[model samples]
Target chain A: MRTYGNSASVVVLLAWLLLPFATARAESIVLASTTSLDNSGLLGRILPAFTAKTGIEVRVVAQGTGQALATAARGDADLVLVHDPEAEAAFMAAGHGKTRVEIAWNDFLFVGPQSDRTAIGGMTDAVAALRLVSEAGAIFVSRGDNSGTDALEKRLWRAAGIVPAGQPWYRDIGGGMGAALNMAAALDGVTLTDRGTWLSFANRRGLVELVHGDARLINRYRVIELDSVRHAGAKLGPAHVLAAWLAGAEGQAAIGAFVLGGEVLFHPGVREIPPGE
Target chain B: MEEFVPIVLRSLAVSLAATGFAIAIGLPLAAALALGRWPGRPIVVVMVNALLGLPPVVVGLVLYLLLSRQGALGVLGWLFTPGAMVLAQTVLATPIVAALAHRAIEGRWRRYGPTMQAAGASRWRALPHLVRMAARGVATAVLAGFGRTVSEVGAVLVVGGNIAGFTRTMTTTITLETSKGNLDLALGIGLVLIGISVAVSATVLVLAGERR
Candidate 1:
């Protein structure tokens, strides 16, 4: 008020310009990111390096994409990294995440026991494979926790025209990917899991990837900076930095390199690069 | 609604099976701990006391790690199976039973012990009376454990896999349907769980009260 001669609008402009730089100097920036970031060990690997370079400690709170966005909306997190596009779009429309950037993209796979028992490989579609599992009454484990993976699973069920709510063969673990995968492994059932967590826990079970690269499998991830106006603690500057870095060369390379058992976890970016010449 | 019936039944089967196994193992073990006084008894007692309120998620995590196909017990093929779930529930319930029994037997040594000793009866004679006096409290413990085994969502969700018509239990069913925005099925399962809990408490109280 004193600097702007009691002008509210100019005071707002000054406040907007000054916050992130001052925040970077004084406070740690907290981010509520997704399970993929945490589970793939990307955040664990890169956050420390980012901190070492920037002198700003990035405290990444990891949760499922739905929960991460919801956490940001509640102002618990200054930013969010999420996978579910529809849910992410809803959050942006609601004025939560003001800046969004495609950070990485992966694919979901219908994984099962390696005996080729269901024979849904090369089917070129998710619904047909789901139907085969249903028709055969082969077991299928679901995350069922309303997570991003769970949401994707539900979308496929709609496409497959199978209401799996009460299906005897369908199992919903109502948990995170790790636990759900454990159950799927035990039962030798079909399940749709993120390639990251699946690969991390792959060797633990009898399960193998049955389907991938289908349109339904296109799992894209993005980072969004929380609108600081709505959230008092939003670290807009570093959040955008992180997001931009993720969409840049080094970050894309990191995404492609994140692996388990020598299998690439994510397919990096299919988004267009900038114009040349 | 018809589709969920089978799921509910499967959950009930798992819940009942876990409860039965808990009682089967917890009761005898609890009885032994309550009556036995030996070296490390206090330590065992303390550990059991601590485990009485163990969070379902923690138990689930330990069990998951131990039983995951890549885990140490993975070769046993128990992860996500009913057996692993039973093992987790049993671990959770055993401490509850032991703690309750320990508390029930806390102060009855003077009057009951002397009376039985004066009657020319052995340690066995005093045993039944101790059992009789502590019956109601022990029953409450069992009932509490049963309620927990049925109402728990985390452990079952983690360990049991909530497989419909397979490992799905009522608690996890309620969680799944509620999260999926299926209110009717969730409510139905919730109401059934409440009924089961009430029935269990009432039956234990009545039976224990009769014995006293």
Candidate 2:
């Protein structure tokens, strides 16, 4: 009505286009997580829900447990979801992570080919099974990648008081769980793997569960916020939110109920005794 | 990633070995095709061409089946070593090199094949000349194959197991870094890879040009 529909409207239109740019930008948090949780679809199922409810955008970068922790140390990621508690504690003590807490629990099992010459069948004891595998030189496959699974496997061997070097049948496969399992299956050998990924593997042609359900077979997962102190100055906003959300009840429940092949894959727990605790 | 530099270097060494082995296998075969005519030459050409598209994972799968502890080549026990990675890259690189070399030589062989014959040179006597002429193209093929071998993540990850301080290669390092969200390290490794590729390609081009 005031003849404002002239060329001045172009400036108004440009202002309209630019007005949204002045508002506060949503802070997107990057979470580096293990392949197990990501592959298990827990992140997929939970992230969308979290974003919808909280309006915080989340970007996930998934890999093996070791890589995730290493990434957090580099300050490239705000948070990490990983399973190797000992390593996570080391990271925390190193000041790479500000706060770390156990968010889930699972078990590691020895998988093997069905012709159980090691007689691992119906055996609930993992140490004994390992002893048999080692003594028999039964082509034991190792995830020699220094991954959490690999680290645990090495610990078990040491705990059992066995050194697995230069043994013809004791093979070191510096690979992922799937590759290690495949290596073992092809050889009909024995190897350690996380139950979640192993149970999820559809190509379990000749593989069978050998040793699980052992007290020592306990597997735990943790979420840690990257520490900027060690990093010499980095923003902790996303890291704080990510760690808080993971420790929150919703995050813990989301973890425990995550499934693989229609079976519950993880048992989340907020309370875990840290090393020397 | 800076963390995986040693790994990538080890993998680069393996790729070099694979390229060396593949060029050894491919050159003679390419030369033979350039000089000789066999009953199944057409069939051989088609086979080599088909092999150009061989998937690395498929090769990895086959090698895994063959070299796994219970498999046929298990006695070699090379399942997790840089050797296995070299073997897989060798297999993948051979066909590419052979095909490219053959294509390069065949076109020239038609023109130069009879010149030597006219000069009372037996086809066998013409071998050296043909090889000299094809050397530049063959060098390029070998360099390209090396590029492919060094940059591959799947086959090496499958065959070598991406073992830290062992069979870890540049490709696997990038993957490990990315998933770990160590973008700085990942970018560092990526830059190294690009640098290596550029330097190698330039060296090959210079060498090829000099020969021409």
Please give the DockQ score of every candidate, comma-separated. 0.01, 0.02
Q: Model 1, range A180-251, lDDT digits (tens) per residue? A: 766777778778888777665523457777888788788877777777777644567777777777778877
Question: Which structure among the candidates has the greatest lDDT?
Answer: 2
Proportion of native contacts kept per candidate: 0.00, 0.00
lDDT for each residue of candidate 1 in B27-103, tens digit (9 for 90 to 100): 66666676666789878888888887899999998887777544677567555456667677877777777677667
Sequence-dependent TM-score of model 2: 0.55
When just chain B is superposed on the true chain B, each candidate scores a TM-score of: 0.88, 0.94
Q: Which stretches of candidate 2 lie over 4 Å from their true place?
A: A1-25, A232-235, A272-277, B1-212
Taken over the whole model, the C-alpha lDDT of each candidate is 0.69, 0.73
Candidate 1 docking classification? incorrect
Clashing pairs in 1: B11-B169
- lDDT (tens digit, per residue) of candidate 2 on A1-277: 2224433643453344233234524755557677766644567666766777666666566557887686566454557788886787788777787667777778989888899898887788887888888877799988887678888888888988999977898888777776776677678888898877777655566989888888888888787766666753334775676667777888878776676667888886786445443
Q: DockQ score for model 2, please?
A: 0.02
